[model samples]
Target chain A: MDLLEVKDLKTYFYTYEGTVKALEGVSFSVGNRKTMGLVGETGCGKSVTALSITRLIPDPPGKIIAGSVLFKKKDLLKVSDEEIRAIRGKDISMIFQEPKSALNPVYTIGDQIAENVLLHDEDLKNLSKKEKKREAWAKSIEALRVVGIAEPERIARSYPHELSGGMCQRSMIALAMVCNPSLLIADEPTTALDVTIQAQILELMKDLIKKFDSSVLLITHNLGVVAETCDDVAVMYAGKIIEKGNVREVFKEPLHPYTKGLMEAIPSVEKRKEALKSIPGSVPNLINPPSGCRFHPRCPYVKEICKEKEPELFDGRVACWLYGGAR
Target chain B: MKLRDYIARRLLLLIPTIIGVTLVTFLLTNLMPGNPVRLLLGERAASPETIAALEAQYGLDRPLYIRYFVYLRNLFMGDLGMAIHTPFPVSTEIMARLPATIELGVTALVLATIVGIAVGIISAVRSNRLSDHVSRVFALTGVSMPVFWLGLMLLLLFYYRLGWLPGMGRLSVSIGLEHITGLHTIDAILTGNLTAFVDAVKHLILPAFCLSWLEMAMIMRITRSSMLEVIRQDYIRTARSKGLRERVVIYRHALRNAMIPTITIVGLSVGALLGGAVLTETVFAWPGIGSFMVESISFKDIPVVLGITVVLAFANIFSNLIVDILYGVLDPRVRYG
Candidate 1:
């Protein structure tokens, strides 16, 4: 069974200029113990989707208009705030892109990690304050060790600024996995790191996932990362999932033109390219998105009909007219 | 960047600043019209012998530079010199009055900080809501109103109209409690005089509140903007994503980071409050260094004016130093060399 399923999720920002449909009808799922890579360009509502699942989007300006996010056979959207909060660190955890900024500067790494462990670990709740602190400290250091941080004890006691970017990212992972969460949502976790460090973090995440048995929803614009780590891929454009399938199937035969454009845009290391192919237009303005397909303006295979009506997702492939509704 | 070394270095840096402050104040006061000897003798006394003797006695007959050196030496010896009008030592008079000013200043600071931070946090958290709007309006009115006008209005309302508080002075005339700390409230408490303590507090409320209004507004505005900026930071979002309680996310994650700048403003406001107290003290006839300085400035009491200036300058520098140390405490990125 799917570990999580989001159906017809619609989130909008009531901004001053106009209503920004940040996430309009976004839908996908991550299978049990599977890594689903949500791929998109900047401002493609990938992060918004993740925030919506956790109900962390700031209200007033941001509102979840419609959706059902089902996790472990329970509708998360319908759950009470208390219920969702209980499930957050225990059942679902998240790691962000900017590692340095993601960690609180004032707190020691151990204090931050221990906080999560103490919050979700029911057995630790009943212990005396001193005992709980001691246990949390030990568990936090263990988590640091599991993420391959050398000198976990020292690193755990250090502040975020005292650590390097890679170390901070590793610590962030440690914080996410400290509670042994069932689902891990990593939003471009390596986007802000050096290429070498990015590769190391990706490897660490893959290894830790196997050890912890936690499903991951990795959100990134890096297709290479998806190819390396994710079992399934979902391509989002202008607040909607335009294409999704098994990573191999999608990468091998990108059904949608938008996905094809993204795939071609990835510069090849073996074959020296004159200039990488980039999609024609930028992401559509969500405040006033395109009437039909969001990618139609940038799609090479755009037809007159593509501008008239939006396509619906068919089968397990894409929501594009070229496939004539996937089989 | 050891904390002890940093503190020692900051202390050492104050010597030159204090020297410079004294030097400038001494020179300026000396350069002003009216001789100290003449001011002491009065215009009606035309006897040159008496004037010369007085000038010689006070060492004012020495050359300007020599007199400046003499003054500096005396200052270093902890002698603030005699007041031209009162014949009392300037330091003694200041010592008597310093506690009152400090009591007012400290009370105003504590009140401003507590109220400002609370209001600012509420405004930021409820941004664009009714409470935010109302607080913003209150902040605006506070900034725009002059301290003297506010002081009088408060006095008229609370003292004259309601008659719930004493109109002026540190304590009621009938309550002659022995002075312990010189600060009426503390002295009253020290002497176990509850009536005097309550009376002293009643007298303090109007002036302190009047003095705090502008600073409170400044602090509130700065804190609100700072908090607004911090709450938008990626870390705040990460804190929420961790499933930490909203209170923890706001206070622990956002407020601490926001406090660095707010602390700086609070430190700056201390200097501003000291300067502002002159007007506040005059309006309320509060027996503090502020009113003493005003009286000394008007009477051309150079020694008293210079003494007060030195004290104020030191107060400003020390507060700023404290703020810097606090910055180090709040943000680990700040390292003192």
Candidate 2:
């Protein structure tokens, strides 16, 4: 059975403009210990998909219209708030994008990390004050050690505001992975980082995956990062995943027209002076997206059928509409 | 600037600011339409020679600027000069009255802080519950009712109508004045005179309530709103998700941050409380600085009035400086600069 399966995930944001269909009929799955990279353009429901899984959708403006995120053999949508909270940072921890803003400024990094351990560890119940403090100390240090922070003892005393951005990000990851969660959702974790720092963080995450023996759902708009770290890839355009397959297969075949366009757009060091390929038009408005395929407007292989009826993801899908139809 | 530097700068700025305050207060008190001599003369006695000699004696016969110079000289030398008709130094009169005002102010502040913070935290914690609604209504009534009117109503209801408490004064004038520290309550405690203590506390209840009600309401509203805003931050969610319980989230995490703005308001309002206590002092006949200012105004004793204004301004400036210093302590991100 798949470790995490999202079936027809639909998260809509109610705005004064209109109910933005952020994630419409989105489906994907991540296997145990398999890193799945979710690639998409900005505002294409990528973050919303991750937020929906955790049920962190902000109220009033955002709502999960429909979805079933099956994690550990249970639909997350059906779980009560208390249960979901238990699952969070314990069963499935998430690493947010901006480290600086994500961590509370007032708290020491030690306290923030100890929160996960304190919340999940049953032994902590009715713990003596001394015992609890000792446990907290051990957990905080252990988390810091795994995240590559030397002198964990001294660093634990430091506050979030005192730490550097990279240090803060590492601390956040340390907190998330402290529980050794089965699945890690890294939503654009490296986007806020510099390119060199991004590579370092990517390597660190990859190392953490091996160390923790957990699967990762790497959400990013960067195809290059996907190539480096992801094993399986999902290409999302507008509000739907246009194509998906093993990373090597998807990169080699360049199946979807949109996928092919994204690949062609990357500047290769090998190519001496090839002019970068630019997609013709902007992404369609999500409030009133085009009737059929969201990418068809910009698809080089756009056909009459592509504009009329949306093509579902076919087996080992390719750009050709001939395959998108009934086998 | 470091927090220290910012505070020092503010304190330094206060010197000139207070001097300016002294000037304005001095001028304004003198500028009032009524004449102190006429008020003192009781509407019956009048002689031009008497008026001229009294004017010369008090130096009111001199130019306004000359009078200001002498006033400043006497003020700097710590002589608040003398009351227009009396030989008693204005400083002595103020010193005598100071304890009464301080007693009333301290009691009122303590009452305000305790009742306001209690109502605020309760309202915030139980938002929309019976306690919250009752407190909200209490705050609304407190804010809307004028302090003088509140005092009168309270005096009538509690003293006249209910006969539950004394209506006025710090202590019964029938009890001979006892000296040490001047606060009747403290002196009673020192002397182990439990009866005096009870009498003093009885005398304090109505006037203190009159002084504190509006301030209490203001604090409650501020604290409630700040707490609400703090409770919504992402850290609050993080704290709750840690399963630390609602008390930890509300009291520990949210209340700490919420207190930053509340502290600022509290400081400024302390100064405002002193200013607004005039009517409370008057209605209760408390003989505090507020009542003293009213009397001085009625007598048109500009020097005494101006002297009190300057002291009040210093208190305000000093409180604000303390508040600015507290802001840094509460939020480290708020640097001196």
TM-score of chain A of each: 0.98, 0.96
**Model 2, C-alpha of B289: deviation from truth (Å):** 2.6
In order, the B-chain TM-scores come to 0.95, 0.90
What's the DockQ of model 1? 0.74
lDDT of 1 at A221: 93
How far residue A100's Cα lies from its native spot in candidate 1, in Å, is 0.6
Off by over 4 Å in 1: A270-273, A325-327, B45-50
lDDT of 1 by residue, A1-327 (tens): 699999999999998899999998988999999999999999999999999999989897899999899999999889988898888877899999999999988888999999888788988967999999999999999999999988999999889989999999999999999988899999999999999999999999999899889999999999999999999999999999999999989999998998988998888886565687788879989999998877888888888778888899977579998887422
TM-score of each: 0.96, 0.78
TM-score of candidate 1 to 2 decimals? 0.96
- What stretches of model 2 exceed 4 Å from their correct place? A122-127, A150-154, A269-277, A280-289, A296-300, A304-308, A316-322, B1-81, B85-251, B279-287, B335-337
Candidate 1 lDDT, B1-337, residue by residue in tens: 6556666777788788777887888888778987877776676866989888888888888898898888888887989888888869999999989999999999999999999999999999999899999999999999999888998999899999999877787877888889777888888888888998898999999899999999999899999999999999888888887788889889888999999889998999999999999999998899999999999988888889989988898899899889977877787777533
Q: What is the DockQ of candidate 2?
A: 0.22
